[model samples]
Target: MKEHKTTPTQEKVLEGMDKVYENLIEFKKKANSDLVVMENGKIIRIKPSTL
Candidate 1:
């Protein structure tokens, strides 16, 4: 298998995405809300506390 290198811009984008995801989870947990997602063509609601 070949290895792929990520550029600096790619790294920054990934880091930003991670931060946004973390914030979303924190907000949901604090508000006692479920995180809505789609899996296997079905919509699912998961509690952040479960994370």
Candidate 2:
């Protein structure tokens, strides 16, 4: 097996994703409805029940 190294940019992006996941977990605990977000001018909805 070989070792792998994460680049600085990849590290930053992973950190950001971790934060977003944490926030979503917290939001799910306190939210009773679905969450909506706009991506590329399109509205995407995520159901809290699925989370």
Candidate 3:
């Protein structure tokens, strides 16, 4: 089987996604932040508030 190595940029992008998912899983209603999500390495706008 052939394996494809991940680039640093791609790894960073995946890491950010993991962080967001983990935060959501451990999330509490009282804890939230003004987080901005990036689209293709560019910040589009601030994300909506979490529950």
The whole-model lDDT of each prediction reads 0.95, 0.86, 0.68
Question: Per-residue lDDT for 3 in model 1?
Answer: 100
Candidate 2's error at 47, in angstroms? 13
Candidate 1: global Cα-lDDT?
A: 0.95
Which segments of model 2 are wrong by more than 4 Å? 33-51
Q: Give the true-structure RMSD of model 1.
A: 1.1
lDDT of 3 by residue, 1-51 (tens): 999999999999999999997776455333544455689989864433542
Off by over 4 Å in 1: none
Clashing pairs in 1: none
By lDDT rank, best first, the candidates go: 1, 2, 3
Is candidate 2 or 3 superior in TM-score? 2
Candidate 1, poorest ten consecutive residues by summed lDDT: 42-51
TM-score, cand. 1 vs. native: 0.86
Q: Considering every candidate listed, which one attains the maximal lDDT?
A: 1
Residue 27, candidate 2: C-alpha displacement in angstroms = 0.6
Query: What is the TM-score ranking, best to worst?
Result: 1, 2, 3
**Candidate closer to the true structure by TM-score (higher is better), 1 or 2:** 1
RMSD of candidate 3 to true structure, Å: 6.7
TM-scores, all models, native as reference: 0.86, 0.58, 0.48
CA shift of 8, model 1, Å: 0.2
